[model samples]
Target: MLITKIYKPAEVEKAADELRKGELIAFPTETVYGLGADATNELAVKRVYLAKGRPSDNPLIVTVSSIEMMEKFATDISDDARKLIKHFWPGSLTFVFKIKPGTLSKTVTGGLKTAAFRMPENEVTRKLIELAQVPIVGPSANSSGKPSPTTAAHVYHDLEGRIAGIVDDGPTQVGVESTIIDMSTNKLVILRPGAVTREEIEEVLQKKLDTDHHEVGKDETPKAPGMKYKHYAPDAQVLIVEEGKWEAALNWAKKQPYLVGIMAPGIEEKTLSKNFVFFDLGNNVEQASHNLFAGLRYFDDKKDVKWILAAGFAEQGLGIAYMNRLKKSAGDQFFID
Candidate 1:
């Protein structure tokens, strides 16, 4: 497949037209680039699965231009969820609600009663969704089990031959997935943490948010799109060092006999051993989030690295979301030492 590059409005519109005709279009979002297809079209949505080789059991998040567009896909929007939508829509927050029967494709919803939906803040993606006049089912642009794409270049690298077009709007700002909240129940359950922190959501709802991270075994059924599988994994093994153990962790890391990768903040890259590849992204949480995936991808591609060692962040605020992704990527291999 030809991966057509689009930078202008007219080009984006042409690409949107192609999407309306059931062609796959990869576009940028504030969080990550998305592989999009017309949500209402079963065949178009199916192409997204074929292109990404994503499991049918995993659902896709539908991106719309406005609340009206979201209404078309959802059967009922709860009062608590509506408050979140009013504030967090056009941002990096996805709400999973009951789907309107026979309105959206069953494949897009993964044969489940609930569908994940969001309206992205990215102008290009919002415009494309509006111009296409259909909800777009968007999963991360990379093939399943790989790092999510935060830059258009990442998208091109992973999906060049698998998709039709890519909108190169530069690197994403948030550099993480959306906060997925299930509003179907009276209480809000955080399915996945991202840019919108749980505190932020709980403050608005005036209620505590439920976060269940227990993994169901392979024999058990999955409750959400990201629950059952190991996702966002790099080619190399990743081990996260617990908080208050950075110095010991670094000492232990330096003594390792194999090539290693370390993601640290405010540390001079040159100070680390020449055998180590250090990803220094400043001491701020924002900068760390932006560089996390890129650093993982870098280590993943290295020929000699045995594993990647990441220092843990504070468990408060956005740090919670950051650690969630790290834990998911590391899975059963995660060690607190």
Candidate 2:
């Protein structure tokens, strides 16, 4: 097994050196801890896929510290993309642009003509890229198909001894992935929804954005992560329940002698039976968004939990992102009342 060191904030220079040497480093971002590598270095980029057990076809996001750096890697940035970048970059949004030829690895692009780019505002990661003198493809630092980690410790649990080092800066502010938009063509389409919502982007661009269109064609490769993948799923079978079908589902779950985990918006444990493990995500949708993945992972760790019964949310603001991840993880096990 590989030895992974957890470094404090002051040791970021060392982390940069490790990155420059073409090794993996798990670092925090506004959204989540990202397993980062030199984007231009083809072999180093491959190591990210190797360490995360991510499918080779899922493209990675090349992160930059500045707009100048972003321009170096992507060309023909549209006015709308620029407006979004100006307002949202160095924050939690990613834009898919036509890549500057030969500037990045085919592995980083996943053999696509365009690549997604983000300029994360996280100080440690921004500086890490600056110090390394190369762009870093920052994917969620977790094993593929698992909950996206929101803390440094979660990264360690998933990637310890697999990567080079971890820049331990504590939990991320936004507990989801970056919002992804494909701007390679004039008509932009959202590839993945995340902390950045479509309403927020529309507010800045003064134009309604495409909230759909991630359906993967038979022979077409997905342009971004989460577009054509069943991700963030725990080992337990996740079943999405209709908004008010809790009692019916509970009765069905009780028939089996296994533990049923219930995830809802409020304190549900007080009313739950012994065979049920209750996870109250939070009082509000934002709080629910923050706690969603963590709750999933928590329930999955409970050896008694053989099935997960998750509640669905109305698609609004960040709720859209929360539901996107939830539905993807739930697969076809949706129970519509």
What are the RMSD figures for all models against the true structure?
Answer: 1.9, 1.5
Model 1 lDDT per residue over 1-337, tens place: 5655655545788888888888888998998889999998899888888888888778889899999988876867888888998888899999988887888766887777888888999988999998989889889999888888988778877878778788888888988889898877676789888899999998888989888677767665454667777888887788887657667777777888888888877678777887787777558777777778777777777868887877668877888777877776776464455
lDDT of 2 by residue, 254-322 (tens): 777989888877645777777888888777778878888888888868988988988788888998888
How well does model 1 score by local distance difference test?
A: 0.82
Clashes of each: 0, 0
- Which residue window of length 10 is worst by lDDT in model 2? 211-220
Task: For candidate 2, give the lDDT.
Answer: 0.86
* TM-scores for every candidate against the unseen true structure: 0.94, 0.96
Predicted candidate 1: what Cα RMSD to the true structure? 1.9
Candidate 1 off by > 4 Å: 3-10, 217-223, 332-337
Off by over 4 Å in 2: none
C-alpha lDDT of residue 93 in model 1: 93
